[model samples]
Target: MEKTLYVASLFFLCFWTKAQENKPYNYFVQESKIVDSGNTIEVNKKGDTVFVAHYKRQDLINTSNQDFIKTYKGTPFFKNGWYRGKVQTGTGMEWEFVMAYNIQKEEIYLSNNPNMEATVMKPVSFTMEGHTFRQYKNQYYEVIYEGGSQIWKEYGCSLIFSNSSQRTGYEAEGGDEYDGEFLKTVKYYLKEGDRLREIPSKNRLFKLFGSKSNDVKNYAKTEGLNLSKEINLVSLFRYYDSL
Candidate 1:
């Protein structure tokens, strides 16, 4: 009877330990605060789980490789967004990447250093106008999009000039002449179908609708869409396509 009771107690203890280890984690909270310990997960505006920080707190013990685990073990790994995979340094030391975001700026910054400065780390790739773009060494490149068109296929320009005359004293007296400087703006374009077109332009609807300009205008009016406002062409195209 004594031996049976001891065995039962030992089995119960082992079962409880295994249950604790297998329990789901709920350590992350969706708040806009800096985590000093680097032990939190953050989600971005696109509803993608992005930021992850894992500070190894377990005792190293007599393990040969401190970070030689076959798989990641810690907070649940997010499968949708970009993550810091295990990397082996030249000196054989393994490290995990840490990431942070500037919520106000809508930018994700990455660094190997857990306590890295926000200004020093590079911003992660993001979607703009329904396309993913990446910035490297001050140059921007389109990473992914629905259409197989390059972001910078062609360029357009706008020029403006103004002039005015002011009377210093009376109409009979001398008048001062003023001329505004000419302002020019360069715009980017992409090829849609057979024509190269500027994005987010009022003329885009004309291209998409062809002879149905009136119908396009009516649709835009019904949807309260201001063609002059800054808009995402891809999103606008999708909306029109649905109709």
Candidate 2:
């Protein structure tokens, strides 16, 4: 009788451990696609693998001493007006720049840290609405240097959830201005967690855009598709497979 009881207890423990690992949770976006160094991979709707994001690393590169205008010779961080930032880990080391999205309070955050030895524009810090989110809801903050200039920058965006489980979407904006034009916008989409979500073999027409119906329409037109079509993981995979 004692032996039987021990075996049953061991069986129950194993079952519970596996159950915890597979607990069902809702991920706002089904998946993501990221590109770096000419390599692109789609992280499909299934969160089984993360091929395109750096989630858990931190490194600080101090830029409190140098002037951005002098270092780059007043060229501005951008000419064509593209958003970019470097990845840092806990050791204060730097990594490559790639278009990225992360979550804060169940929303996505995008940011890049400055390089070490750069000057800061001011004493920089951040604040969020809730204390439970002290670390969890942290956003990508700007790193300013000593001459009151921006050395580098980071951005954050979040997906606003719907009352229904069938839809999910987000919006973001951050970049430089040039040639008398400023650009910023918002967007929304439907995604399901069960499908495999990966980075598209190429950047998606949707990811590179904003909420403007015209711009989205133009991009889709360039790709020989339509902007108003609703998509989920299964349909996305089928579309990619046909391509």
Candidate 3:
């Protein structure tokens, strides 16, 4: 009987050792970024959407590669008007979906970094002080934002978003001026020291459209560029050189 007991104890030790050797990997998600400590998975490319799953059991059935998606809402701060942009805050708030703007045709363009592809367009149209701006389908807003002082080179005869709410009066970023729904006049400047301004004049929109005046300015203060007609090769080499 003692021999039998000794054999059983040896078998238990071997089983425990095997279990420790085959521990499952651990992973955590943050915003759009994912980190795996166990080195179990790999990301083949950037901006490539992937599926993730959580495990509650020890068995393979306890694990999953299910897809999970997050959503976010952003307010615009352009001279045009307020817009609702989408955001995804998975795991942590590291990943974001940003919309690029185009001044030529006066439209909003959506894209991720490294790749500039026009996916969706947020139509903007409104009248301010008897002036009207419309997207009209033919025109589009393409977001051609390049980080750093490179934004200054974007000034031209075309209209561009200041990228900040405190900015007003436009300076040529892509064009000499900005034209669209949110802006009252064709020629305007979006200077750095300008006051945080909006189109439709809060009081005027409230009196004319019967819409909330402060609400209009509030939305524009946070989001820029309203709807309008629109008409770019983005030369990164030139942009970098301008820096």
Candidate 4:
């Protein structure tokens, strides 16, 4: 009886451990706070926490310490004690940058777009069922399959060029200057596949979906999901594969 009870208890423990392993880690909700001098704590939506300290930035000056050689225009602020800096790559460049210093890990995460306001670095990849998935913001995800085939599905806003015209602008005096105006539109990508194909119109969904259109719509309705929403394409495809 004693041995049987021990065996049953071990089995239950293993089951609980497996359940914890299957829980998804939330990469969203990048929040951080400073605890003390040079110390900061960061937490994600999944409740996983990390403590960082000793954050520092490279001074934008030459060894001579004379005049400013490299200029960084934007001022950095601390969130939960972690310093976020928008470091410009010199002047006359078309790009802005942001970076974070993890003093404990001695690591740095660079922002691809300076125009974005968020400064916290998000986890780029997560594993599910031994398959690795990479996320690019909330727009799309790239799934690396077991056979090494990379499948990408992206849904987001894209600019559409409309029309162009020239308009005259009058300066202080009699000088007149002409400027070109270009119109644009916002559109969303529909459907998921290995390639990003632009949907010219809602009518094109018929061609894109072909005979599977009705089936896909039915499945979406049954699941109470709207395809037009920011759906998780990876999870959607996984459910489709199960069918």
Write one digit per residue (lDDT tens) for candidate 4, span 68-176: 1111111111122223343322221222234443222222244444443222333344322232334444332334321211234332221121222211122244322
Compose the digit string of candidate 1's lDDT tens values, residues 65-96.
Answer: 22111111122222223344332223333333
Per-candidate TM equals 0.28, 0.20, 0.17, 0.25
Q: Which candidate do you rate higher for TM-score, 2 or 4?
A: 4
| Alpha-carbon deviation at 142 in model 3, angstroms | 16
List clashing residue pairs in candidate 1: none
TM-score, candidate number 3: 0.17
Residue range 1-243, candidate 3, lDDT tens digits: 698657654743554455446444222222223232222111224532222222232235857443322211111223322233442222122212344333433444333432322333433532222323333234422223334311111211222232322112343355322121122223211112332112232234333222343554454445442323111112321232343
Q: Provide the overall lDDT of each model, using Cα atoms, as 2-decimal numbers.
A: 0.38, 0.28, 0.30, 0.34
The per-candidate count of clashes, in order, stands at: 0, 45, 53, 3
lDDT of 2 by residue, 111-218 (tens): 233221121111112222210111212433332211211122233333322222111112133222111111222232222233212223233634522344345444
Residue-pair clashes, model 3: 53
Off by over 4 Å in 1: 1-109, 114-196, 203-205, 228-235
